[model samples]
Target: MKVAPAPSKAEVISLGCRLNISESEQIRALLADENNVVVINSCAVTSEAVRQTRQAIRRARRNRPDARLIVTGCAADIEREQLSAMQEVDGLIANTQKLDSRAWNVPASSRPVLAQHTRAFVTVQNGCDHACTFCIIPKGRGSSRSLTISEVLSDVEHHLSQGAAEVVLTGVDVTSWGHDLPGQPSLGQLVHAILERFPELSRLRMSSLDGVEIDTDLFDLFAGEERVMPHLHLSLQSGDDLILKRMKRRHSRKDAVDLVRRLRKYRPDLAIGADIIAGFPTETEDMHAQNKSIITELGIVHGHIFPYSPRPDTPAARMPQVDRAIIKQRAAELRAETQKCRDRWLINLIGTEQQVLAEKDGTGYAPSFARIQLPEGTPAGRILNVKPKKLEKGLLK
Candidate 1:
């Protein structure tokens, strides 16, 4: 008996970060030619990712009324019950294994799957053991688990065969990767393994990392390898020790500072960035000032600030809530302080050489934590050596 072919499709999409974007690209490539099947990759990190996801879905539904929709990713993972109940979505996938079109509840089309972009995200690990008070990822994703080395290597080989320009290793706790392996594989070992097995991989980027994961041996790997990008994103929620304790963060202010110092020592040209929560519950004015001062003293290249949003089922949520007025005020102040530091950094870069990966839309270069806006007609999606000619306040030069 001959099997019949599936129909064609369109897709809606959203991405959380570099890693999310990478994985989502792969998902879209798989669903690209379903003729009438559509996929919408959703994100729910900040308020912005959610807004973007909704907007993308709305546009997809409007443009292709007959297309079957598959919504998946962090946003959907956290709210699976809610997402599955949505009238628009025919299917949803969390931080799960790559499911075929058969499970998608949509008939498969005979159209060929394609490569989405120049780079791809190969997630070797998919869960988190750490439970930061403010985070809800563990709720969405289960306990720490890793994909077999063979599984990951197979994906890497396939990526190289498909001509991937780069691969970003992604996970909730990428540093804790290989912990569940038989020999308890370390991050350095996995990195070395990938490099040795796939010499064609030009560049490999790490997703977000934590201070607890920093070690001298890992830095040796970075120092020994040029394929690793000279960039790092460390999660540092607060600079005040008391606030950190309250937030139940495993790392202290000193730990974060030391991590930055060590990374920069190894790679002088490294662009360092941090995440911050401006107003945790019961955080006082002095504590906020301490947090601001620490960031300024560390000389981080930039900061991504978030006003404290209490999530349900977290210890921090039950703590005495600070007045909304106070939270808002502190958030604004932290933002302003961080803005000054960022602007000063940009100002100094007016005459420096940088490797910039520009976008195809001829938009601008998102160099680490900052965005560099050039003349609109400039070429997109090319890594070019750029010299900052001038500075326009805090954003770009």
Candidate 2:
């Protein structure tokens, strides 16, 4: 069998989440042997994110003076004209176009070099249908769509062939998958299908999920499937009931707490993570306190804390604004609390044996997604059975 040639030197600078990283791999494959081209797959979750994207474009141009630079991703889709106005950018591609091979004039035979060796992120779904008041993602990503079951299985086979130990299903709204497909299958069905088809797949993981949409099959898999990783990152934006309502989020504090509690009952070692926004429009001190308390109450070891930044044209941007100083302060407080939670979890794992997938430079991640530094010269992409002896800095030693 003829092996695909190694990826060429074309640069792909990815910003934002794992979904963008997955798409960047495709961009790299499409533009592989092409000369003097740099692709910036951007993120536009917040205004600060967009600013950083622009800064990256400038840095890329300065470093490679003659390269033809192209910008794509959510930022390009939402603010095409603004990015086009920048002198450094030679072309612009939309979020949808980024995944389509025809947009890059490349054949469909080109396959992505999934990043980090140990794991591959397969984008099973895209876009969001829910209209959360603070979000601009649906406008940037358009309506939700999904890849067919066969298409996803093919990709999984390819990844496993390349020796990926884990495959993480990613999307703009992962739980919203299959709504556009035949029979209106649930995300749970997709998970069950993947596991059934590929019994050899060692580990399967998922990106962020919305608490409200998790179906019965998924919950059962969470409870009984040992192959599925025990960590879950939830899209729990706020913990205050009034703030959640104001943000148009689907779940309340009680709902989130109850879901975590129930999942923990099924798998005692389950590690819960969450995304929280600090100081949304009209948020008060009591509301921020509730957000802080829920981090401890729910035992969320992994926390993605974002200081609320109003995006242009979003409903929250037009609502009564929180003071910038207050937002910064509240975000700091949340970060500090998150550190304490993380530390407590790590300390609890001191003498436990963990199955770790080595990523690079003698470092790997346990099933709970905690980083662990291993013995020297351990090959990347190898899974090892390790007994964590100590906590050094923030990593397991």
Model 2, range 1-397, lDDT digits (tens) per residue? Answer: 9998654467999999899988898788777657678899999998889999999999999998888898999999888899999999999988888878777766675565544467989889999999899999888899999999999999899888888889999999999999999899999999999999999987999899998899999988988898889999999999899999999988889989998889989899999899999999999999999999999998889999999999888899999999999999999999899999999999999889999999877899888898898989999888898988999899899
Task: Determine the C-alpha RMSD for candidate 2 after optimal superposition of all C-alphas.
Answer: 3.7
Clashes of each: 13, 0
Model 1 has an lDDT value of 0.71
Where model 1 places Cα greater than 4 Å from the true spot, the runs are 1-8, 45-65, 84-102, 105-116, 363-382, 393-397
Q: By TM-score, how accurate is candidate 1? A: 0.83
Single out the weakest 10-residue window by summed lDDT for candidate 2.
108-117
TM-score of each: 0.83, 0.96
Runs in model 2 with CA error above 4 Å?
A: 1-8, 107-116
**How far is 71's C-alpha from truth in model 2 (Å)?**
0.2
| Candidate 1 lDDT over residue span 232-265, tens digit each | 7677888999999887788888888777677678
lDDT to native, each model: 0.71, 0.90
